[model samples]
Target: MWLFVVLGAVLVLVGAVWALQGFGMLGGSAMTGSTLWAVIGPIVALVGLALIVIGIARRSRSS
Candidate 1:
């Protein structure tokens, strides 16, 4: 339960930063190569959100 929440938070933050950097919103020169985080960050964030929701629902049902 708590784990999901933590992971979700981390993912959301990482995803946001990656998305920002990837989109050049940070206003910096592009790197020589593509960064995987730009893809991974959002995916991880979604997974984390799903995990958190599932955990919450499961806990609620059990209780």
Candidate 2:
């Protein structure tokens, strides 16, 4: 549903930011350069991508 798409988009955006911060590409945070965030960020982004795919698939089926 639209909700899934919205949530997925938000997650992707947040994950990207977290990843950037974790990689020290984006500064000004305690999480900057943290290995934990660096690892988890990609996972979260992947999950968001999955959600978006699932939402689109369902939408297409329903239509």
Candidate 3:
């Protein structure tokens, strides 16, 4: 469960960065202003959130 939570958090951060880059909010990368990342970023973030929720729930249940 902890693993899930940690991995999820990492994914969420990465997704946020990707989203920012894709939207041109962050620069200095090829991904900056790319439409593909803009679309995929939120999806990855949502998956990360789901993993976090699952991890928490599993932890609670195990306890």
Candidate 4:
């Protein structure tokens, strides 16, 4: 439970970073020639969101 929450948070952070770069808000990967990153950014973000939702749902069910 706690582990899930922590993992979800970390995924969210990583996703946000990837998304930022993909949207051209940040540097690094955005400037690189990887269209894969551009696509992956949003996907990662969604995955992160799903993870968070699952963690919350699991906790709520337990309590």
**Can you give the lDDT of residue 52 in candidate 2?**
93
| Model 1 spans with C-alpha error above 4 angstroms | 27-35
Candidate 1 vs. true structure, TM-score = 0.65
- Per-candidate clash tally: 0, 0, 0, 0
Query: Which digits, one per residue and each the tens of the lDDT, describe model 2 over residues 41-63?
Result: 88888889988988898899999
Better-scoring candidate (lDDT), 1 or 3: 3
Q: What's the best-to-worst order under lDDT?
A: 3, 2, 4, 1
Candidate 1 residues 1-63, lDDT tens each? 667667767777766766666655654546212366566656766876787787788778878
Give, for candidate 1, the lowest lDDT window spanning 10 residues: 25-34
lDDT of 2: 0.90
**What's model 4's overall lDDT?**
0.73
Each candidate: RMSD to true structure? 3.0, 0.5, 0.5, 2.2
What lDDT does candidate 2 reach at residue 47?
86
Worst 10 residues of 3 by lDDT: 39-48
Better of 3 and 4 by TM-score: 3
Any residue pairs clashing in model 3, and if so which?
A: none
Supply candidate 2's per-residue lDDT for 13. Answer: 89
**Model 4 segments more than 4 A misplaced:** 29-33
Candidate with top lDDT is 3
lDDT of 1: 0.67
